[model samples]
Target: MLRQCTRPIPRWRTVSNVLYARCRTTAPCQPISPVSARTGWVGCLYSTAAASQSQPTTDGHIEILGRLHPTDSATNVSPTIVSKTTRRLHLQRNHPINILKRRIESHFRDYAVMDSMDPVVTVHQNFDSLLFTPDHPGRAATDTYYVNTNTVLRTHTSAHQSDVLKTRKADGYLLTADVYRRDEIDVSHYPVFHQMEGIRTFDKKKIEEEAKVDSETSAIQGAVLSESNPIQPAHTTREAQLVDLHLRHSLEGMVRDLFREEKDLQIRWIEAYFPFTSPSWEMEVFYRGNWLELLGCGVMQQEILDKSGNSDRIGWAFGLGLERIAMVMFDIPDIRLFWSTDDRFISQFSSGQIVKFQPFSKYPACYKDISFWCSETFHDNDFAEVVRDVAGDLAENVELIDQFQHPKTKRTSRCFRINYRSMDRTFTNEEVDRIQDQVRQVTKERLGVELR
Candidate 1:
């Protein structure tokens, strides 16, 4: 979701884990910017193109998490994403995201919970620490929101994995935080979302000792191990099998617990890949006659553990988006509603509860299409970002309705349809047309594409 504009800084009050920003005077308080309401620090909003061109402060730097950061061409962190830095939706008491977080915490009661990590992190921490290759597409400017050449809005909670593992303070831990990504405009896709990373380490010697007491500890059950997802070369087959079994069993059990109320919930695991984890597998659950991927897990890469001074420990790690599960469990049809301040939305949820979301009346949608010749550097996410920056949450969806390539010039012409609608009220045709015009102007100027 995206938003803009600034209002008077206000005092905050928390009720049932929802932060409300209250104005100091009798003047009506605007909607609380989630992070500002919780942290008592606010930032002025800027459009993506404006933010890219102008620094937030006179010093040619931007204020993020109460610190100044130098900006350059690499600075792509928009004010919309900046505002989400401190939202901490997972920490909100009655929010569905938090409810899911607490439910998982209940299943892993002994795991240490870490939820307050800063969203801004060094590129090394966000990518290199997790073993992402230098040329990986995720590192591209179009996909990531870079604070500068060296920092970024952490794309995943896993960015903190290496640092957290270094402490070696907890045998198991659960880290939850808001994660940012440049994405499409759709009901399920949003630029800012939340994730929870869970890790559990086991001392090989202890596992070996326990295996003698209980043979089942070393057995891999109901899982087919293939060459494609083999144990790492550095790990003993027995230890790897043990850890893999523990990982799958733990996750399957947690899923069952989360969906215990549903009748006959079915889950299956499939082989997967990730730069940081070897022999990875993704868990998916059958829901509404479709398969919904729930999370990804694998035996921790040996190098990661070795780097953390735990060469002797073998472990399993998994990460899941709280929003994905919450949406499915709560029947939330639109992702933007999660960020809404509407009483109708908030009143239906409570801490420790799993209730289906009842959507309020939806306003009509206004459609506008823009056709343009593709530029060499154009990316779909760039177009989406422009629409988000210009239209904010009012832009419900953007779809590529038509595309064609000119045979002689070898140039591509594409058209996108933007669905404009207000969550609270109807939009006049003039208002939507005006917004669409801004989108066209921005697209041409920022993207360097020719209007068709």
Candidate 2:
């Protein structure tokens, strides 16, 4: 057997349940596989050394989990472990009996069912290779967990999308089963979590045109399109946002159908940010007039697309927390309840029943924009914070549309388009202008900004 640890083994009751539910048999629960048994032994041996973990001293002795691999080009075993620390930290996990678990099985079942006929149906990938740039914080020893030598637990399922795109068949739909890491270990956050990442590529010009039309539809709401009311460049600034919004709505709709009793289900798009997506968005579900964020999505960045050999085509993708959705559906407040090992919680949940979700608008949203000039001492971010404080709930989207440095004064000028539209009622031009004036005053007082 591989090295083994004496510490209490985590009960695999949840894992067993998952296997039983999906496989409908105890085949996977039998004797440990030969390979797994070997790995267990290795883990146990390493655990004895590392579990005695102690703080490193200036003398330079560091803690290591296992010995160096034979392929590492080192024939001699070092007496001391090398020390390297990273600044960035990440925590990741997946939960037991949680919504995410249920969803994964659901998707897996659907894929299996569909593949029986098409065989070309996209399926989720489980394991993925991980590479961190030399400068990447994740590469630092202090920031991540080391699984064996080259492999580490995946942080997010999306991490494998690039790998799948490069290796998998290029035709038909493809999905990946991935997980990611974060620092928080709380009721809501697990050390690992599951994510579904999807990819598709086609003619760019055609997709771009389709995106242009969708953008208009998204921005106008219920407005009817006509020759006079044409979609403008401003409307299609980010096709990814609109496309993501579409996907979110469709997903939420399907979720509601799955739980037939749910009602008034609506998906609202809110601005969000992430490194991999431009013009990213978070989808919120309206619950009892309160909004709860449910999912994140956006168009894939060009760099990621190029790396996947789809540089010539456009791509879009998204990820959602299954637990968060389940929480909203079941009115569960603390995420820990799902993993509490409490028989009551699990028994209370409806296995295959639909729950009703009523949608209602509590507060109206308003948007406005202002142009101003300021010294190099302040930037758009600084200005946005000030606006957020003054506008409160009345403010919708605040963005820097234009920026330039003065050729003569050496000062900077920024144009911000602030939107003002309330769910309650439309605002008068005068009312919005007055609020704009207040924002301008705050900017001037705080950052020495001058209204343009």
Candidate 3:
């Protein structure tokens, strides 16, 4: 007799590797702008509809990250988006975020904390499961960094939600992972950040029975239960209200637990919208005299639940930025402080402890301005990225200070102000000048531009 298979079916273990990436050829380049051959906007690596279908003459040089990544788009890997701190996975151990994450996990004894879910996923997983429309602005190259046409660095931790739900046998999961986005320069914004995704479900038939338990159930007693948020019309008011109550109750408890020490902490619920949920709501806390939005959540869309093989289950999902919460809870001012190698920043907090950060001295900054006439394809994020690469941690701020067009020639000229500062020490004028000079050279060479 043939032996029956003994081992259980493989779960989500193999596909859970976290996403953590260059250029190809340096041939003589030609103009890529549509007006190039006419106006002599030469050597611009611009991509047009036709060019994407067929390679133009000498498009641009491509850089590969060893043999691990292959080129399939305009640019494959960017060092600007990949930082040592990002690749190090700060959420693993000996890190304050990890401490907070573990403590958060302790509160949900039955939920699985997925710390190692892959950060790399297909465009479909990142956008489709989330029900993003095709014209959604988030799909643009300026907003997201792509590995290729089909693959991408996950823009949010929710990318893993569908995969996890479909593969796992558990009723709930919490995902903590690094997410990516190409963004403008500021103290608050970075290309890479951490997010915690929480999702839980209950049997739809059970929810119907629970709706009969009345509004004063122990699960929702201290928690406010108002139908300010919406639900699908497809479901009965009783069913939707029951699911909504449980969602709000659980999330509010988590928020209150995060700031449990402050008995009087101001928290409120605001209705919002998300592609994957109906009548979404955001949780905000009144802190430092301002109401800061903390997390977005809603009852999971029925379509998504069905996709997860949970047509019989009603559930909800919420995602919060770890950096934003940590900054507020710990009183850390600058986002860069989290990556500081200095012990002074890292020593204040021990494992499993939440402490306010002490202020450090601010070093003086040096500013340098570079002006040039660039092709229409020149993006602010691309320029900022190059500045980061050439100047490293020394480049603190990148901003476009000036822009204008010549009336007669119609040539567009723009100036960017790059503030050079060190978190550890101040830079001398000479040292700064040298770095700025290198920045100017590399900016022109890497990005085809005519200096003004």
- For all the candidates, what are their Cα RMSDs to the real structure? 10.4, 21.1, 13.3
Top-lDDT structure, candidate number: 1
Better of 1 and 2 by TM-score: 1
TM-score of each: 0.86, 0.44, 0.80
The 10-residue segment of model 1 with minimum total lDDT is 11-20
- lDDT on C-alpha atoms for all candidate structures: 0.71, 0.39, 0.61
User: Cα lDDT of model 2 overall?
Assistant: 0.39
lDDT of 1 by residue, 196-297 (tens): 788989888897653232336522364466888878888888887777777887887788899889678877776766666667776667766666556667
**Model 1 spans > 4 angstroms off:** 1-58, 209-223
Deviating ranges (above 4 Å) for candidate 2: 1-143, 148-150, 167-182, 205-260, 331-351, 354-452
Q: 2 or 3: which has the higher TM-score?
A: 3
Model 2: what TM-score? 0.44
Per-residue error (Å), model 1, residue 319? 0.7
lDDT of 3 at 20: 12
Model 1 lDDT at residue 342: 74
The all-Cα superposition gives candidate 1 an RMSD in Å to the true structure of 10.4
Which parts of model 3 are misplaced by more than 4 Å? 1-67, 74-76, 83-90, 209-230
Give one digit per residue, the lDDT tens place, for model 3 in 1-452: 00001111111100011111001111322111111100000111212222222121233322322323333653433644443323534464656667667777777778888877666578899888767788776677775667667767777777788888886578788888776666555455556666677888777778766433345633444223346545676566666667777777777677778878878777776555566777666565776556655666777788887887777877777776666667667776656666666778777878788888887789898998999999988888777666655665566678889999999998899999988777777779998887777767766776789988
